[model samples]
Target: MTILLMLVQIIVLFVLVMLHVAYATYFERKIIGHMQVRLGPMQVGWHGLLQPIADGIKSFFKEDIIPEQADRPTFMAAPIICLVAMMTSLAVLPFAKGWVLADINIGLLFIFAMSSLASYGVVLAGWASNSKFSFLGGLRSMAQVISYEIAMGLSLVGVMLMSGSLNLTQIVEAQGNSILGMYLLPQCIGFFVFFISMLAETNRVPFDLPEAETELVSGYCTEYSGMRYAIFFMAEYIGMMVMAAIGTVCFLGGWNGPFAVPFFPPLWFLLKIYLFMFIFIWIRATLPRYRYDQLMDLGWKLLIPLALVNIVVTACLKAMIG
Candidate 1:
């Protein structure tokens, strides 16, 4: 029975994640469409509710293409690697009390490690494609991912310091009793750094230089098509959801609400995630893509230093309090 229950939970979580990824694409299109003064996807279903399903079906049936010179094995493995890495990060996120896939002590570090692994997929995909644009995209992805990852990891140190544990649940618990209960308030600087880094980590605009359509013709996945391309897309969206979930867990107090309003904590969590997703879409619509040089400079010069400062301040406060 215990094993059966665990299987059920895994199935449910898998379905939920996939549904979220599918709808996220639809949501992005609708939001961006409205921003540009156009009605989006009303033809598929009401407000294009069925659009994602149609897209999934179309991609599955479409011809899978490989460039003549492409390395077939690595090319196929790349998207799977990307998707799996992102999904693995979700295991440690606590949706509500007693509602996590793995309640391990090193949950935070596990997530960070898994997130870092995702870059390999981009790098491999680009290299395997044997295209100049793909190669350049892969190079950019590697540099950008590593640069932002430093800031991203450093930003979380502040949370770890205050929470006194690497466990994500403990981090959320630590926020429950303070005047500025949520880490978002006291660690505002860290939150800012992490939030910006989240955009970079997920390769969302204006940091989407890896797939900058105009310059690199879809970036690292330039040679991909059909379901292979869809896997890349799925991985991208799942990465976005993971980043949003991390933001909710680390900074916003995952499943923490004002009162135990029965059946509402998950709702709160979802709301926070959607809010971040909206910001992601909003920024994409409002900001033009950053130049490659400018993006690199911002990550290295601005975000990294800010994240370091946040860690320093947080550590000092913890020491003084102790």
Candidate 2:
């Protein structure tokens, strides 16, 4: 009975996430459209509210194409690998007190591992495509993720040290213990580094070298079409959501707010996640993509060192205060 209940919960969560991922596209387009001084999607439904549903239907029925020269098995598997890893990371997130799919002790580490695994999908997609553009994009993604992942990991070390636990829920509770009710102030440097790394990790504007259309013709996904392509797209959005959730949990005080609603405990958590999402779209509309060299330099030269320093400083301060 317990296993069955868990399975049911997993199913429900999966459906909800899928729905969120679909609407996330609509919201991103609408948000960016408005930012650029234009109406986004007004065709599908009232104010284009149904656009995401329409897109899902179209992508589902669209022809799935495979190149003759492409490695058929691996090409088909890459997107699945990517999507699975991102979805798996959601299990450990504590939506609110007592609201989590997996309340494991090493929840944070589990998320990190899944994130790293998702990169394999991109690399595989690039290689299996048998195209130079895809290859370059994959190579770029590999290097970028590797570089930024290091910074991201190091940046969170402060949170780990302060919280003294790897569980996501405990981390949030630790923030609740803080005078500010958040680590945003004390771990400001870590947050800064983490924020930048989050952008790079999700391949957002200025750091989307992996899929730079101008040079690599959509990067590693140029060859994908229909549902396969849609899967990759969904994975990207889910990745964004996951990163937002992480930032919310680690720095913004997960699910903590000025006031609590009796019916909706996860309300604050959802709002913070959307706040991160909005910033993502806002930046996309505002900033130009960085040159590949500049992206690498920023990740390796700037962010990494900053993360390292933040860790050391946090350790020293923790010791002094203790």
| Best TM-score among the predictions, by candidate number | 2
Task: Give the number of the best model, judged by lDDT.
Answer: 2
Give candidate 2 regions above 4 Å deviation. Answer: none
Instruction: State the C-alpha lDDT per candidate.
Output: 0.90, 0.94
Candidate 2 shows a clash count of 0
Per-residue CA lDDT of candidate 1, range 1-322, in tens?
Answer: 9889988999999998999989999989999999999988899988799999999999999999999999999999999999899988888989887789899999989988988889999999999999999999999999999999999999999888888899988888888876555888888999999998999999998899998998899889999999999998988898898889889988888877766657555877888899999999999999988998998899899988998898888888878988
Per-prediction TM-score: 0.97, 0.99
Window of ten residues with lowest summed lDDT in model 2: 173-182
Residue 146, candidate 2: how far off, in angstroms?
0.6
Q: Which pairs clash inside model 1?
A: none
Worst 10 residues of 1 by lDDT: 256-265
